[model samples]
Each structure stands twice: as structure tokens, then as C-alpha cells.
Target: MQCISANAIFGYKKSAKDIHKLEIDDETAFIVEMIFDYALTGKNSIQIAKMLNEQQIKTPAWYKNKCDRRSYEVDSKTIWTSAKVMKIIRDQRYAGDMVGNVRATTKVAKNDNIRVDRKEWIIVENTHKGIVSKEIFRKVNEEIMPIKERSNVAVGESRRQGFCYCAYCGRLLQKENNPVNPYLFCVRQKYDVKNGCDEMKIMTIPLQATLSAMVVKYVSSLIELQTFVKRSKMKIFQNHKSAMTGDEIEKEILKLKQSTISLNQRYHEGRFTKEAYILQKDKIRIQIEELEDKKLQILNGIGDKEAQKEWEKELEEKIEKFKDRISFTESELAEVISRVDVYSQTEIRVKWRFMDFTAKATDYLVRAQKIAC
Candidate 1:
């Protein structure tokens, strides 16, 4: 994994045989955390980027692309931009995982790197400790999802239209001059969605209404999910209650005890001197005593129910803070939603942020894609 990209939190180990683990860069990690936190406050990528640049913070790309690490040019060229901020949030690496072979190999040199469908790509999670929690990562990306541009959108077009897509084509919908399929519709041109999709259009007005309501509902449900997950994590840890498995320590104990038994049998058969036998028995018994002590230490650490509960509380509080920042502001309705798909004037598919969190929360309350037409 470290071999693929130089942008890893931690670079590859000196040992070639070692797994490429994420090494946290203390300097950049704080920067990343700040960016994610600011983003939750209804700031767009451009706004967040501007703030970071004004604070004289070095961009992540600055650490990567600059040939001379020492040069300090005080110009816009040496600062964070919207594109950089959006790229960091969109990356799966900040969530502490890397995906490989996501694009099919192509013959054309420039147009060759088309992304494969997500289902077809390989995903390996929890490979290393993430700088941001999975929930935080998901939350940030949920905010800044790109919307397609339109040529003839009305002045009063719904801000929610930025979150809409074409159900048939999976492209971000574009508002146009067409009266019949007015508002967000797909002109599938990107290879990712263009092929295998028939032309599709959705009426803009109703889609905006449906999505706005859904956004409010999902954010409300997140409050309960945060509370439930806190208790559940603690209960899970307490139930297991062991740092090392019982089988591991027991196996070691059994192995050492059998060595003493073998020594006794050998002594009876006159295979060694009494002096030799005594020394060997003493060594085996010492090992047994050490293992017993280690077993007790491990058990005591895991059995600290109070400690585990306290830790869970701290985690829950952090999650609450993160969740509190997530909201659908009137100015940035586009930030919270990824895309809505248009099926008809009365029906559309809304893909909200926090897929797993939102999916579970809105399971009975909302439909996924197919809604009333």
C-alpha cells in the first residue's frame, strides 16, 4: 500500500517484509482534522480552502509536489485551494484504507484511467488507524459532493438541485431550458454513467421538496444512532472481557507442564544425573510461574469494566460533537446531500450522507430510490 502512493500518513517501513502501516504525521494530522471540522459547519470546499490558506497553513499537496521543501513564496500559487481541500475530503485514505485496481487498464494514453464501477473495485478497510474516524470521513465527503453545471437554470432554482442526479444514468443532473424535462436531467457523457443508460429526466420542483424533507429527517435520526452505538460498543467490550484469548495462555501453560512431566519420566529411567534433572525442573517451573503472572495481568486489564465504560463515554461525546456539526443549512443544502435521482415529477431517489448511519436510521421512514410517482 505504501508503495502505491507517497501521500500516506506513514511511509513504508525500512524492512521490506513489513506490512505498509499508516504512520501518522503529527504535523499534517492536525491540519486534516481542522479541515474536516470546518467543513461540517456548512462551508463549501472553496470557503474552507480560503480560510486554511489565510491561516498560513501549508497545503497537503505542498508537502508532496514542491521540489524544494525550503522555498516560501508568499503568493496564491503557494496556498491551499478549493480543489485541494475537496481532494483530501474525497480521499478514502484519511479514513485509513486504500483501494486498488479501481480503474480498468486502457489503450489510450490520456483517456485511459477511467474509474471502474464501485462494486467492481476492491475495498480493504481498517488497514491502519485513520486520522479521522470512519464516521467523520463519511460526513465530510457527504458535504462537498460535486454537482453538475447547468446552462439555463432559473434565478430561484432550489439550492437542493445541486444534490440531484439522473436515476437512469447516475450522472449529476443539469438544469436546462427544456420545458418537459426541465430542471435536473442527465446528459450522460462521462464514461462512468453514459453507456448502458437510456435518456432520463426529472422535474426539478418536486425533487427539491422531497429531498429537503428527507435531509431534515436523516439528521434527526443520527442523534439516536449516536446514543445507541455508544452503549452497544461498551456492552460488546465487557462481554468479551479479555486482552489475550484463553486458548493462547492455556496452550502455553500446557506445553510447559508437559515438559516437566517428560523430565520426570526421563529421570526415573536414569537418563540424566540428579543435578541435571533438578536444574531443568527449576527452569520449567520458573517459566510456569511467569506465565501465571502474565495471565493475571492480562485478565485484570480486560476486566476493568469501569475503564472501558469511561472510554466509551469519551468516544460517544466526540461522535456527538461531530454529529452536531452536520446539518442542512439553507445556504448549503447541496453540501449534505450527494445526489438525488429523478424518476418522475413526483418520484425521485435521494442518496444522503452517512450511508450506513442514514440507511439504518431512515430504513422504515424513507424509501431508497423508488418512491411515490
Candidate 2:
């Protein structure tokens, strides 16, 4: 039987140079482990850091700060900051990857850390044993980031965030609310635009509601199409029956015409009198007219089969686009839709994940209001 400490960091010890190595000290390893767990369990960085402080868990900065040597109250500020907790959680080191020079100093040789461009940073993957799975770490970051960003974001689902893009410049839109209403502004303009974004800002509620209405119509059209197809299939049998009857009538008319010719030939050959031949011809003419009338009665049922096939094919293709489509809620619009291009009130184009439901992008008058936001 062998025993091992839960805090063991596989290969090295507590030191500055050793920080980049696969090894970590017992205390730091435990802290990293706890932060990872807390993040997975929905604890934001602030909450995790506060919990750690309350538990009196010595931070990794204890050595640098000389907390024990100094006469400090050991409050939340002295112990750990939310940024420290987030940094630990964001570390690629736990995922068996190495990242270097994440922060650089200002040009004048100050110890202060400044954010460096991601392109300038060094990143190496699969360097050592990982404490947390990369998938878990990825999920934690994804979940935590949205939580942190939610205060400003109007509304979004976990799957729907970051799918939005500006209609004009194609920059992503960020959710925001004014005292009047919630809207999405072009992130380019919101953060950094050389001059300004020429794109129109989208009001979230009206835009979402309009999208949902368009999807509803799309879905309704599909249902109606399916019903029409069923009725059309039923009419197929009736059409075949009518066609057969028309063919039979045509054959009968041809036979009667032949008989009438034979009768005319008999009269010319003097095999029958003029009156008899005339009467016989008249009978055949009447029979032919009757058959033609019967054929005409069923003519409407006959249709262009090739044109019908094409129409059905087109409907089938449209139906295929919405196979997974369902009755959508307002929020679920984000699930099916990838993005929306607001050309104007009437010309809003919704690019769906499956396909564009608003194919025409018309019919904005869902209410008394002339158009959607």
C-alpha cells in the first residue's frame, strides 16, 4: 500500500522559476484545485475568492506580500482578490499547456504588469500532467465569462451568445439597455471605432419579437404545405380515374366516327337510301358530341404532371429547411437563428442556423405599428 498527499503537484516545488514547470507546491496546488471545483459549481471569481478568504486559506501571494511578517488585518483585500481567483482559473497550466509573457511591463522599466497582445504571447500545449481536464477548463471559462458579462448584456442563452454580428460592418453587437429600452449596439462603435459605426442599432425586444413572428409564419406555411400535399396526393387517384375515363371517351368517339364514315360510304355505294344514311350519320354525330361533353366534364382534373412534380419538389425543399423547426418561444429565437440583418423596418433578414425562415423578409406589420425595431 502506498500513500500520497492530495496537495501533491507531481514534479517540482514552490519557487519563482518553477512556476512554469509541471510541478506546484502543496498549498498552491490545493488552491488551484479548489478554484477549479468552485468555478464548475457556478461560483463566480468574487464568490470563490471571498469563500477562500473567509476560510483563511493563505493565498499564493503570501510569500511575495509577506503577510505573516507584516501587521495586517488579513481582510478580503489582504487575502485574495477576485482577479487572482479568475487568473488561477484561466491558467492554461492546469490544462497541461504553458503560456508565457502573458503580461509585459511598460517601456520605462516599471514592475507594473500591463496587458500584452495575445499574438505576442507564447503558448505551448500538452507539456505536462493536467489537474483539470481541458474540456472542464473550457466550460468553466465559457460559463464564467458570460456570467461576468451578463450585467451589461440585455439577454442571451448559453448557446446563443457571440453569434450576433453587425449588419453593416459585420462587427458583433453587444446587448445594452437605456432608461427607455434594451437594445443591441454595434460593438465596434461601443468599444473602438475610428470614426463611428454607420450601422443602425437594434432594439432587442422588438427585433426578437419580429423574428419570432416571421419564424411562426414560416412554420405555418410549412404546415399548410404539408396539408396541401396530403390533399394533392388524394387528388392523384381522382386524376388518374378521370384520365382513364377521358381516354375511354376518346376511343368511343373515334369508333363512332369510323362507323359514320362506313355509313356514308354505304350511302354513296347505294347500299342504303339518303334518308337512312343521313339519319345514321346524325346518330353517330350526336354520340360523338355526348362523349366529348363527358370528356370536357373531367378535363379540369387533368393537370401538368411535370409542373406538379416541380411544385412538390420545391415545397419539399422548403419543408426540409424547417424539419427541426418547432413552436419557438421568444428566447428560443436565438437557438434557431444565427443572426439578423436589419436592413430596415420591413426588410429585416433573419439568417437561421437551419436556413433563413424569413425568405422574403417582408410582412413587418404584425401589429398597428408599421414595422419592427
Candidate 3:
């Protein structure tokens, strides 16, 4: 027998007030209140389920089916199933976070539907609250979400997976929703109303692979760019330093100050009107202030020598540790690499941090080839 009352879920009890006060979305609050109500009434889930059935209250599935104009054929016996009750109590959707399908299609397919990979799930935070503590709900979800196998193959290729766009037009050209059969589609088809992508029809997987491979190769070219930047950064810094001459800046400052003094004298003698004098003085004052700030910065030094040295030491340590390692985890990869852009066919373009260039050029190339034909 439960000790809690149903109304305790609503109108706020001392124990649940802290959680209730939290600004959660309406959907989440509704779930939380429902759970609290069930707990407070001292009734087990079955008793509550029976009560709901007696009242002919709608279930989430029933409501959704009704909204879609679909027929409800399920037995009342299964409507109050403990699994369904537990699922509602534990759902994270009430916690104000949006969790959604990462790879599954809206259209039912010929073959068995497989679960989407966790990496594929598009999640956004601050969605809602739960019936229980967030920590408890998270633990329950961990038990529920599909665990990935080390060597598990994804059932279907994602629609926009590993895709990049044209910087000029933002048109994404690639094959999407590839399973046993795939289609190539232009991003402009979805976004633009007029004169969308003026391009070729959906090429087969093999052509996409080839194009993707070329794109990857194109991005790998940036390795040379990384090398070039590494070699030239010191030279660039030296050139910038040389351009700032203290004596020339000081001369300009003195000239501006002299002009300001002359302007003030003309105003005191009533040779200039008040508004004209003020406008001229304001412009000169701004320039003088800028020159002063530059002079101060030069005196204090333009760069952080200690911080720079610390970073250099940290880089050396990381390089030493990773020198013998064959590869990096995703986090390490993210630290060095920026974005990967995909182009039409099998092209993979990559951008890296200033120091070095590294690309998963081989994997993408192989995938594209496998996809072709």
C-alpha cells in the first residue's frame, strides 16, 4: 500500500515544492503532477490504472491514435500494463528536454525497422521535468536506451549523414536515406521556393561514394595549408609588431592635443560658436583617447609572455604523450579538428586547428566507394 495521496501531486506539498517551483514546460509539469497524484493516493499503479479505465480517461497512445484518426483496437486489459505506467513515470520528455529520432524514417519500410544509434539522436536540453527525481529518471533511461555494440553495424544510412554544403548557396548535395535503396537530393529542394538547385538527378550510391572520396581528398589538401601556417605565424606576428612605431604614434598624439588646445582658446575668445567648438573638440578628444590607450598597451606589453610559455609547455607535453599513440578519441579529435564539410559525390572537406591537419579522409573515401554502384 502506498502512503501518498493523489491531490498531493497538485497544490504543492512541502517535499515536492522545490521541484515544482522549477520552471518546467507544461507537458512535463502535467506528467509530474500525475505521478505525484498516484503516489499520494496510497494506491499501486494497477489500482490507479483501473480507476483511469473506469473513468474512460485517455492514454497517451490512445490520444495520439485519435488525433491521427487511427483505429484503437487494443484490449482494456493491456491499457493498464505496469510497463506503460512505469514508462510514463520515467519519461524524460516531461523534464523539458527534446529527444528525438536520429535516423528512423517517417515512412514504414519493406524490411524490419531498427533502432537509431545514440550518436544519431538529436537532443536539445531544457525541455521538461519528470514524476521522479531527474537523477532517478536518467538512471531509468540509461537502462532503457539501446546500448551500442563495439562492432554493431548501423541498419540504415542517415539522410543527411556526414554532409557539408556550398558556402555560397548553402546547397547540400548528397545521397540520403540509403538503406537497401538510396536517393540523392538537393538541400535547396526543401528550403527554396524558386529556382532551387539547378543540378543533376539523384545519382546512385557508387557515384556518391566517388564524389565523397574526391571531396575528402580536397579537404586533406589543407594539411599543406596547416604546414604553411605553422611556418609563417612567427613571421606574421613580427610584421605586425614592426608596423607599430611608438615614436610615430607619440608624434600624432602630440599633434591632436595641440589642436584641441587651439580649439578651446578660439571658443574662449568667442571666435567659434559653442556647438561648432564642442563638435570639433569631441572628435579630437576621441582620437587623443585612442592614442593614449595604444601608448598604455605598448608600455604594458602587447602579449602575455607567461601565459604563452605555459601553453607552449602544455603543447609539448601533449605531443610527447600522443607521439606513439596510433589514434585519438572523439574528444581529442575535436580539440585539433574544426568542421568537416561534405560536397557532391564522395567529397569530404576538412578544417583543422592552426597547428596541424588531420582527416578521417580514408574512412569517408572507403564508405563512398562502397556506396557507389
Which ranges of candidate 1 are over 4 A from the true structure?
1-3, 6-19, 65-76, 108-112, 143-373
List model 3 lDDT by residue over 137-190, tens digit each.
554345432333112323345334433344324444555556776755554433
Q: How high a TM-score does candidate 2 get? A: 0.32
TM-score on alpha carbons, each prediction: 0.34, 0.32, 0.29
- The lDDT per prediction is 0.58, 0.59, 0.48
Consecutive 10-residue window with the lowest summed lDDT within model 1: 364-373
- Once all C-alphas are superposed, what RMSD does model 3 give against the true structure? 18.2
- Higher-scoring candidate on lDDT, 1 or 3: 1
lDDT of 2 by residue, 72-155 (tens): 443322345565676666666678776666667666666656666557878778766677789888888776555653233221
| Candidate 3: worst-modelled 10 consecutive residues by lDDT | 1-10
Which pairs in model 2 have colliding backbones? none
RMSD of 1: 23.1
Which segments of candidate 2 are over 4 A away from where they belong? 1-20, 63-77, 105-113, 144-373
Count backbone overlaps in model 2. Answer: 0
Name the better of 2 and 3 by TM-score.
2
